[model samples]
Target: MKKGFKYVFMTLLVVALMLGSFLLGNKMAITTGDKVILNKSDFNIYSKTNQMKAVIDKYFLFDVDERKLEDGVYKGLFKGLNDPYSEYLTKEEFDSFKQSTSGEYKGIGIFITVTEDNLIQVVSPIKDSPAFKAGIKPDDIIYSVNGKVYPGDKLNEATAIMKGKDGDEVKLVIKRKNSTGAYDSIDMDLKVEKIKLLTVESKVIDDLGYLHISQFGEHTYKEFTENYEELKSQNVKGIIIDLRNNPGGLKDSCVKIADYLLPEGPIVKTVDKNKKEEVDMSDAKEENIPMVVLINGGSASASEILSGAIKDYKKATIVGENSYGKGIVQTIAPAKSFGIDDNGAIKLTVQEYFTPKDNKIHEIGVKPDIEVKLPDDIINFGPDFIDTDTQLQKAIEILK
Candidate 1:
């Protein structure tokens, strides 16, 4: 009887050990197998991270959810990443990210900034967006959506709350302070629609033709160049290019427009994180046509590049307020891991751009030759801060 009992006990012990080994192997594979490699040396310490992760899992308050851990690991990995343009987006958030890339979404079409005071203030609304349609003006601070305060949240979250299925309604509670008085808690409901930006707005204001290039969209250069050709064919003597509230897009598109406008040598130069500088060359095309470019505080990135280049080359008259001072350039690189993280999209600020004169415009924005602020008559109507557009008028006058 004693011998039989020993055999059964030994067999049970052996089975238990085998099961434990299998569980441990499975755990290790789930947690540590899917690793990402970053180009930098700092990310090389991931092997040692396995021991640390095991400790964290043991001491963690709640059950260690592997999925959440995977996300945290990926996000933590990017903690050492220096670029602000590069970030990890959650699955749902990534799906809702508002990039001008695919170019189709809806909401009260306004770009807003989260202020230090926990206020969501409008930077500017796209021309004829739902925000413009619902009378949500610029400088209006959004306090809540559907009565839920969302301060300190991601801008994408606030934007998501405001966007929905077409014909759906979104309520926004806003706060605005100006010369009139303190108007707080103003509420507005805007209907969501399929929003497509019409980047180019052209018209003939007397002898000169006016073209407003809002952004460098996918087909911006095609539209811009074709319009210029039409203007030249129409015998328009002067041209005014309005880049007010224009945030730049594709670098090539900006260069294309610059090439058309200037008898170009160097359009812009880029210095990467490695401090390597590359000069972008341009072919002269729109050299002799008298031109004026209008800019404002909202003009940034590629917009600044184009305006700065034109001004440096004496190719066009720069009009209006100083441009928004973003001089960094970004390139999107693939994500390393295909499993936990979707291929990583890296937007490294590889270089700081310089104009033809080798002028650097990092924090200090472009200064227009003619400085003008918007008039109050336009400001009082809604939340919009109307820049007098006297500069645009001046350009038109010069062209005429």
Candidate 2:
């Protein structure tokens, strides 16, 4: 009887263990099995919490809550990424980002970046804005915002705190590198204001037509065309196309600007990972004007493409610090995949861009023919400030 009882207990235990394994496996299959890739050999995504999530939702909670699951999963996933750039922006935050890029967002002007140490730092301040007038400088490490301590290694929380209704005050505790101590809490009253984008600014300085292209916004082509016509009307001796701090936008604008500058030849070519090619639009019949391009580290993407093409074609003299080296072109993919989020949005580096002369402008930046550093004291000018504009000055000297 004792032996029979022991045997029965062992059998029951074995049956219970098998049932538990089946339930766990089935839960994972229902929740996260869909994320598994078929062809990829090296990439694998494993989530043990999905099984726990399934158990809680089905047996314990009995109420479906996607918000809880989404937040839980997102926090879990992003924390592991360890890349400040790699983050999960809620729909609202994502909308804000899109609006900011589209020149539709309202806020006191400031550009920001996350340093390697996970501290948010000011990259630059827009001139005539609250931040600029308040004396915020680049490389100022933000310690706290609005009396709230920074959340554990999360920038999203800090961003949410910084943004609010117009007329709201954001208190910032900042630490400057060369300073002896951190700044006492300073209040920056953010005024909600629409960004008025001016793509082109032209003036004749000493018989030389200076056209500054601030950005490649939506109406860039129209502005550039009108400015070019106006400059021609002025009969300027020469042109200095200033593209400093132009982080580039619409490819069409760059091409249009190149069309106005280049006499002919391919402006740029894009080579895909598969080695396929597409030549960027350019014009050969345009007049080869006596022009100089001014670029710096802030000039990137389309700017790099245009400058590289002009230099390779020997169409214009590139004068400034090295141009930002961004050779990869990203393409939006259609159809949904497991790793991708909504909007069916996937931005994979589809190709590498090359100059008409087949020169690669990847990690290696475009070297200037005449290099001149902008003055550090010129910080007072902010984004609109161009004190000495050493590169522009050099361009003028060359034109003379």
Candidate 3:
């Protein structure tokens, strides 16, 4: 789900697009972490591939594009790993991925994520956007785009399919689950248009400051800092950081905000395949303000980084259910770097990141110091519905 701003986990959670070209067959150089490793593989995969290709070239009756054939093999490299996060992207999909971090783009404004069952599900529709006006709601499964079914693993393709000329219409088939657990299929046609991302929203309730980070984007740190100044101007006593339903975005943005909040200490650490560790530390003087971080199943990757760091330093009280627990990092490189063309790209799982306390948060999420659970039906609430947000009320109570 990514290709921009260092390490991105959510792939923008948007309809933004990034385009590039792809080429193939140079198997020597591979990008790992920040380095390109050049060495012959211990396995004779090239030989096996050539053998299979020879048969296809000699015996297959139907004509096949040799480039596409090789591209399929290249894609199989990542797919064979069987890791859900790592993937191969065509030029169109890669372009869509790069556009995700820009904070604005053209599309049918909708935020989507992968369900636990690996189905593409909508998180929410952007206010006043085509999807929103069409009555699309949170938790609705995106069954198909343009009449073609796209599974969770192929979400990048689905997102790419949503992009087109301004005013272009995109057909959507959604599967919405009803109260009785029965799913009702609905079809809607929405037009693609330019939309800006609002990553952070803030509020002041008497002495308490409330900051809701929908997701980390390229400009989120700037937005957060601006809001923090406003909260300070209001003479806020404490701050509540809400990371519920935040899938996560740019790692650099997350690190910047964490650095802004914490003191001269390690914010997070990353371990590469060789077990080499790098620590990201903050240089700012510590702020002694009281803090409570709120997280739920949707809090992941970069979200986990910020919450875990705050908790590690004992700088905040963590509340709500366990986070989404994505501790690994993924990096994408243009396929041409490995000697491929047609704007092809490869996103591979490069490293695992740990909290400041050296705690692992991959499958095991960051646990709350004080755990609270919201009813399933009420998990998604707007700012206007503060009374129904028990986790937020609990945070406010702690701050008070």
Candidate 4:
């Protein structure tokens, strides 16, 4: 891969790694996005670390593992950014991250994000996957993994524990909201399996097409196009796009799908720290049918891109609550370019994205045209839950 690699619109969760040589700390010159350059001599701050290392080497009670210490320095480097989305990936984590974009992996099959308070929140479980079948729902909190508590900062470590050989059981302690607005702890022993990515799940609800997009993976565009075409062939007159609890994924996948539904215009725009701007546009061709997009707190990044575009152009009526409001973008740059490659890469926050109308999505989410919250009675998104789905019923009411 080249220096500036893929522009990903998703959060690839991970942290912690074994240490290696600190070739990067001493003589290497590193460049920052904001035109800051750090060379060896300018890095006298390392003297403090060295002083601590000397003290630990002399008086520490137990043997110090240089491997883990080195890894800590690497992680600490990125953690200095204070941006939760930006992280340094180890070789193993990087490999797994690549596999996740490909839409398949050996894990319990759930998308997750770490909160500001260092809690791990489940965005959604992949439909039909182990976690999905186990009834793990959105907004669920993961307290511990395999009896070990991993703070939000150690998300990568927790995920590492979750993924493994098929049929291997891993225990997860979850905190779920219950009746009377209380939280309940639940223990689950989930089996690791090879989860095949099926991002788009579609079926006809009378004359309307209901398509729930879990995430925008690499194959998402192709799958979305094929599924929409199938719905068209079946004479479905309207559409309901479900993005609830959908953790966003690839930018390109979302762009292509946006192009299919929208008329010629800018889908989304991004500007980096250098004030450099790039706008993704759609063609004149468009789908003319009535459309309703469903979004909630979990609908983020590229999902906001599509829904924002649809809202900007009045292409679709938005339903449900406000979105997750993650307007910033991240990229996986080749670590080799920085002379720090051990088959690993760095995911850095490169740019802040805007909706087509130039509205910022960073901390403020997109508002729905008609707001309808999910009813308290509706729990799982099972077949029987649709009638009680107030947001969905509102969408149906709009189309009718």
Residues 1-400 of candidate 4 have per-residue lDDT tens digits of 1122111101110100111112354464434444324444444445455556668778999977776776676788888777888988878888898899898899998989877787889877887889988878778999999999888889998998899888889999999888768899999999999999889989888799889898999999998989999999999889999988788889989999999999998999999999999999999999998999999877888899989899999999999999988898999865886796455678999999998999999889899999888766455562346767888888888898
TM-score quality measure for candidate 1? 0.74
Show where candidate 4 strays beyond 4 Å: 1-42, 177-182, 382-384
Instruction: State the lDDT of candidate 3 residue by residue for 1-400, as single tens digits.
Output: 0123112212321211232212225544333445543223522465456557668778999988765665677677876787767878878767777786777788897778665577998765655568867877666899999999988877776887786768888999999888799999999999998877788889887688888887888889999999988998898999888887677788999999999999889999999999999899999676677999998876888999999999998999999989877898888889888785447788888999999989999989899999987765563454566788788888888988
Candidate ranking (TM-score, best to worst): 4, 3, 1, 2
lDDT tens digits, residue span 1-400, model 2: 1243335445544543453321333232222244432221111232234345547656874555666455545655655656433455555666666565565455656656566677776654554567667777655667777776674365667766666666767777776664355454444445545455576777777688887776676777788779877888888878888776666666777887787767656888888768789887665667555888888766767778888888887777889888766666655333245454343233345678888888888768688888887775554521234445666667878999
Top-scoring candidate (lDDT): 4
Give the distance in Å from residue 33's predicted Cα in candidate 1 to where it truly belongs: 21
Summarize candidate 1's per-residue lDDT along 102-179 as a digit string, tens digits. Answer: 466666677665455545777556777778766665567888887788773345568777776788888888876767
Find the candidate with the highest TM-score and give its number: 4
Q: What is the C-alpha lDDT of each candidate?
A: 0.69, 0.64, 0.79, 0.82
What does the lDDT come to for candidate 3? 0.79
TM-score of 2: 0.70
Q: RMSD of candidate 3 to the true fold?
A: 10.0
Candidate 4's TM-score: 0.86
